[model samples]
Target: MRHLFLNGPVQNGPFTFATRPGKAVGIRLAAALNAILGLPPTPHLWNTVTLAGDLRHREADGPTIPRQRFEADLITDKYPPGQFPVGGIMTDTDAEVARLALEMIENNLCAGTLTISRETVPSCRACGHMTGTGSHPCNACGSTDTEDRTGLHLVAELAKDRPVLDRSDIHASHRQQPRHLQNTAGNVAERLILSRTRDHGIDLSPHGLDGLVLDPRVGIHVTVLAAARRHEADTAVMTITENAANHIAAHGQHFREHGGARLQYALHGYLPYDHTASLQPLHEAYRATQAIKESFETWFLPLFSLRTKTATSPEQLPALFKHYMRAHLAQPAEVNAAAFNAVQHAVGAGNVSWITNKQGLANVMAARRAPIPSAAGPAHG
Candidate 1:
């Protein structure tokens, strides 16, 4: 199976990796997994189709710099200087993603899964922003005056045959399937609005829904598939948190599969990055170097999150740190082929138990320093 892991497109919000390392967890996880699999790098995904993005752009040189350029600039700043991504960056509204989204929508329409229907939605009278079903003031333009407006919008009728998220929709081993997440994600409304009035997005003008754009939730799925299609990956595993997965699962119902490719969410947990500094004492005791500490925080912890599937508490950091140091100390002079192959297969099979094994971690660390396998092929990230 050709599997590619891609980070769920992060919102182009105000935060850098240096300040909020949590934001880069998904990106780091994807890169680490792809490296282990001997697959080329995959493009990092970004979500620019947001109302906050519109207001931010307008506030900061609206006419001077393009929104795309604005979002790209912010993403670049998130990376370290001179260490830009080798896989490049793919935004939600990229031309290729837009084209593929429209094509997918068309196919869904033909299959009667999606429709162009007239919807009476509340809109801000000031900026014409879709305020949604709420009595509160508009998020955009801060307008309290809202009125119901009728327009042709893209709508999706939730299928009755299956839940929004099923076991098959998750990238997990049989024993680790998240039944609770599956139940929660399927709790969305039966009918969904797939179009929004965002300033920057995959425009639906081509479908005659003028001034409307594809909802970011659906665009997120398309962005992953778009990246997967580029790499010729049949199975695209999107690294995301369970909370995020539940939020977008319903909207992505019809967007998960297209042509011969399939998209699956690999649920990961939250890291207590704020508490990492407290591990300095433990670091000293273990004689852990800066390199070992950095690796444990950035790489190992993200992989550990895949196993935990929920918030890893601050109290657990010290033990986790000690575990990592032990693995670092156990690193062999060379990677054992048999051990490395098992680790690789575990990754491909969505099994993460090997992550906590000391010997397994040592073998993986050694494998990272070795020459790339001939099967790794050319740069694709």
Candidate 2:
């Protein structure tokens, strides 16, 4: 199958990638794997259809900017000057994503997997925002008073024949499957309300569910599929955290596949960016150059996260760096065609074992260097 790795849509919160490097793990992981597979860069996906976004826009002091422009500007700020992604950016509420989401929703509604019905939910008494089922004050207006409000909502009926998130929904080898995520993702109610009160989102008004938007959880799925569709990929592998996958999997049940394209989560772990400074001594010892340091931080670290599917502890940094330096040092004088092909095949087949194997990593690194022979000079480290 033709596959492409895409980051799980990131929330457009107020944070720069420089300060919060952890947030870019998914994006970096997807980019690394896609590069290994020889796929062109894919647009970085962002989830701008968030309540936080709405609140931020509302509270901004100035002549009002369009919500779309406001989100675009915020996303652009995440990257450093002149360092935006080469593949460009795509927000969850982009026109193409909205179109795809509505199409999927319609198909689900027709197939009895989704329905539009009146739902009674808690609402902030002061601001008329949906407060969900919590005792805390409203997130939008910080009001303590809430009331049970009834309104039209788009609902999804979880598939009766299968779990919300099964093995097929994940992009991992059988032995590496995430059982905990599967169990927890299936723990939600049988019926899920898929519409929300948002000032900006994939508007459900097109389907007669006026004043509501597609749930961001589900919209994120469509965003991935929409990006895959653009590239004509049959399978879109989304790099996401296990916790995030569990939170959104249930809502994305009926939205994972469309037009012969399927979406699957590739669960990854957090990196210890805070402890990366610990590698300073190693950098000195290895005489690492800026390129080598960047390659380790942006490429190898993310790929490593796939192997260690939980947080990579601060203590593990030294060992991980040593392993990386070993691979860097062992990078073959020339690409091994057979080994390179094997690594590509393994990447396509969702086998991450090669990442931890020194020889395999060397061969893959050789392959990465092959395209630009002039740039394949010995690593200064």
| Whole-structure CA lDDT of model 1 | 0.91
Best by lDDT, which number?
Answer: 1
lDDT of 2: 0.89
Q: Write the per-residue lDDT of candidate 2 for residues 220-284, one digit (tens) a residue.
A: 99999999999999999999998898889999899999988899999999999988888999999
lDDT of each: 0.91, 0.89
- After superposition, the stretches of candidate 2 with alpha carbons farther than 4 Å from their true spots are 372-381
What are the models' TM-scores? 0.96, 0.96
Please write out the lDDT profile of model 1 over residues 182-225, one tens digit for every residue. Answer: 89988888999999988899999999999999999999999999
